[model samples]
Target chain A: MEKRYLDYIDDVVSRIDTDSQTKNKIKQSLTEHIEALIEKHGSLAYNKLDPVEKVAWEFSENLQLQDRKEYSYPWPRRYPVWRRVSQKKIFNIPLYHITDGYNPETGEFEIARGIFAFGPVALGVFTAGGIALGVFSFAGISAGVLLALGGLSLSALASLGGAAVAGLFAAGGMAVSFGLSIGGFAVGHIAIGGEVFGEYIYKTTTGEGNAVEWFRNYLPYFVKFFQ
Target chain B: MITIEIRKELKSGVIELAILALLVRREMYGYELSQKILDLSSGQIEVKEGTLYPILYRLEERGIITSRWQAPLGRGKPRKYYYVTGKGRQYFAGYRKEWNVVVEFMCKILE
Candidate 1:
């Protein structure tokens, strides 16, 4: 039964993608959900029972999951306003307006936890840069000026490149979220581990910044060397 | 006469199988499935509107059937069409044989 659940998840993941970093994270999230379900339900959910015996109990008993409304805002107005020039009060003249409000006044998009996971890291980096630039200035060293320049340049480049990479991660994550929503997921609570994992993978791959990972990978002995 | 309780249970199971078998033969939208069942039963088996969706979802969850939402030609509400899987076909084929055996056994007992 465990094997079947895992295989089913593998089937689902194969239907998605393997090359994407966010894809892998979402795949892991789904696998974890499946595992937890089987554990909680005790493998009966996937039991290969006789169809005749199964239908009566399974059909009415199992509740279908309703759609998750993740991000809902009012429907955006499509038509643009145009002001015609008049001889009097030309600047204040109001000309035309169009208003169309269709059904589903609430616009909803499935927001993946992974997609939302970037808010803090980006905030942290931007804040850290502001603090560093605020506290540290060219204290009369030629090298200090060069270091500051390099730091600012790297930070600026990281911000721009990071936004693009973050967009890709968001797209991939959103796809998984959409897939899960379509596939029927109802959760009471979710842990923060998945979010952190997603953010780290997204930032590192997109070249946003990961000073700890860089240090661990490149300067293993430099920890005590600094002392 | 079979008891009403037994008859209802039998009918529900049979109705579910009938729906699956119908999809196996061809893809169908929800309204089409309801109409076909009513037609096949000669108007004896009318399904409640609310009851059918859960059954559809269950079949989808089991991977026996899949649904796609598509807009009709010209403007209209999108309908979900369900198509059968290979596994569904195999399950239904065996189920039909078992049903025949049960019916034959019941006939002999009722005589």
Candidate 2:
């Protein structure tokens, strides 16, 4: 086996510099500006061009595009879309809306909204981000309709996280719900946890408020059958 | 006479204010805003055309302006558009006054 020759020197480390998160925006801006210039002025006018225009005209000449193609997307012109969208009559929406605004890459930010959205701030049917709101959301703090799982989660159905509260069932370190609850500290109609409290609760060791009612209603029938 | 280096530095200094001023008139995308600056200044206020985005991002972070994505003619591909916020309008008005003061003071000495 032959070792491949390396062109550059050792991978250096411990370099210090202020990496402005805006570098990504600059990069994206340059790319679009060049493309736009080429689209507006074909190579025939290359001699009259300057700055980024020269490169754009060169591309236009080389590519032999009589007309520069225009993208529908505005600034931060390109988005990472999962599939090629098909034109429909009834409704239209992208499947995924995600951006890395803080990473100094793609240099853009918007409330990400799609079927599946991921960004610093996101909203969708299903979303994950620092702060999220959707039908089903997962983030540092989230609120969802069906389910929400995060540090602080709230939902209409089942909410699960460090601290969770739901309309129906909830479970976590601190859980509160209406129907059933199970966690370290649970509160619901039927509760089960280390420290549980509710209207009719069955804690780990024994049933508390409604235990006597169950014992009275069923115990006499069982005793008669045995006799 | 302003040297090329000094001219560039001066132009860059007012670039932020220029952006806010124009955006106050109407919403424009990044490229359009850059081109408008070039056209209005007759290519005199030339900075690296690509540098505008970083400035825009910074301005946005400061709540001086805001941005949104909209498709041309409300159909097909989306494009991000920028507009001045209420804070930005007030900002430009106040800053312009300060800039006028600077110009008057500078003229007293340099002239």
Candidate 3:
């Protein structure tokens, strides 16, 4: 309603990094709020308002802008204590065990051992973190018997991650498998991806190719393998 | 007095729960909502319009609440009325439980 308030609103809006639609919505809401305040106060001049009212308006505008910045760039937000903590062991076991380093006493290059282990060289029934080997593994580099999901997973029956190599089904950015594989670059008995090199390949980018017959033929075998 | 930083952080954390709890009873406009918070808190909690609106927008985006513009019967600008959605109620129920736990723990520790 007033020029000063409109100027303040404009300044606040300009600082926000959101899209035009959101910006407009915020502007409309803020304008309506100020208008309502004016109606309640029975005054057009901001200076004429009570000290408490003035402070409330100022605090409201500033805090809203601060919150916008916080939300837009959420990296600075405080995480819970439990989420921040990282562990190398479970139940006092040498899970992140290492050997063959400068100091053996420090447990460098040691083979890890635990139910859920994580380390440079780890082994467990269900393991994760760096260089993991387990029944169900997830790591930067991992190998599992049944299922593996990680950055560079290998030697799994069913693996899903980046750069995966599996015996059965594999899905990743770059996958190499004996059975069906789906990725950006796949090579398998039945490969499906943007760029595939296999006997029965299905390229999705160009939308040209026929792997339906191959899939239909192999569907029963695939289901049997899973069973 | 508690430091401004602590006050800000505390307010930010609990404001959503407070607003949702208040809105469980009835729909409210921006000014009315702020005033109700003040009244309910006995002036202990103050919901600034600036902070209240952004939180409302975020809640709306998450489909926790819905808003509609209501025209005045006389000759004033239409006001946007906000109502908590079913999703909001479900979330609030869980949040309220967690909040009660925190409150109980704090009370025990203080005692």
Candidate 4:
């Protein structure tokens, strides 16, 4: 019964598009909730159960249907937003505007000033939701002046994602940096990963090598040596 | 009886406000929150995981609420507890005021 419940949870999670951290959180919460329900109802096999059981069954069924139909999982509601601009104004001053549509020929990209904004070429101190170019940007592809984080990110200082390139520090599946890089494949002055090539390289054949731990162990000594 | 479609629509509209209001008093885990909603509404409302999780995620994304995982005391797995933020409280106040005005106007019109 536990296995069945776990299988159902895994199935639903597999279909969702999200980062590993968010996905793990969702899975943990769902597992805990189901465990609580099982404790309350006595058993998952109980014939006459309460609302929780009914809802759990229905949710699993829905996920199965969604899977069969090949429907894309709905975007997670908790996607972080950088800023939110209201009515294209800040304190009655026209601080930003979102273009209705992207026209590369016309060169009209979205210029927004909000806690969260979206556009083709988004420009805000903190922005997201499209080829975001900002101080702290997040998008399908993003370039952050200081810190960039996304599926594919480029930054002047630090970057983290599937593929990241940075002037200073980078961490991802594939990462390149001037100073420190950690990933499955990495290149930098100090590189650590499964396949690494750098001036200072720490390569591991095992894929599960802990890059962060390695960094923690060596960073202080490296800092002192430089100082 | 109202149609399932209409019922779902109604629930969707009010669930966020209900969640925010409940979390105002205390932090709760997902299942606990759902159970409270059912009990408080006298079984008039039932919150499904399918519906509840998305709303929770959305609220968190909007920075209205935050969550942390608490390890179990003995043998069970950890649980994620959610608590409303100050922004959530302010938002709830505005939402409650608007809801009251709308309800009052509707009652007058219906009468």
Best by lDDT: 3
Q: Report, for candidate 2, the interface RMSD.
A: 8.9
Docking outcome class, model 1? incorrect
Judging by lDDT, tell me the better candidate of 3 and 4: 3
Candidate 1 lDDT over residue span A55-138, tens digit each: 322322222111111123243332111111112322342121111211111233211111111111111111121212211111
Stretches of candidate 4 exceeding 4 Å from the true structure:
A15-23, A45-227, B1-8, B72-75
In the predicted model 1, the residue pairs found to clash are none
lDDT of 3 by residue, A34-102 (tens): 777777776654653334433334344433533443454324532110111123556765444332111
Model 1 residue A55 lDDT? 30
Interface RMSD of each: 12.4, 8.9, 4.1, 3.9
Ranking of all predicted structures according to DockQ, beginning with the best and ending with the worst: 3, 4, 2, 1
Which rank order by lDDT, best down to worst?
Answer: 3, 4, 2, 1
Best by TM-score: 3
> What would the per-residue lDDT of candidate 2 be over residues A1-227, giving only the tens digit for each residue?
01110100000000101123332344455444544554566553333334344333322222222122222223332212211111222235567766433221222345676777777677778888888889999989988999999999999999999999999989999899997777889998766677888875555554344523443575555323222
lDDT of each: 0.38, 0.62, 0.70, 0.68
Quality of model 4 by C-alpha lDDT: 0.68
Enumerate the candidates' DockQ scores in order: 0.05, 0.10, 0.20, 0.19
Instruction: Please give the distance, in angstroms, between residue A156's alpha carbon in candidate 1 and its true position after superposition.
Output: 53
Model 1 residue B94 distance off true place after TM-score fit, in angstroms? 1.4
Tens-digit lDDT string for candidate 4 (B1-111): 221222544665588888988899999889888889888877767776766876788789899999998876886667788999999889889989988998899899999
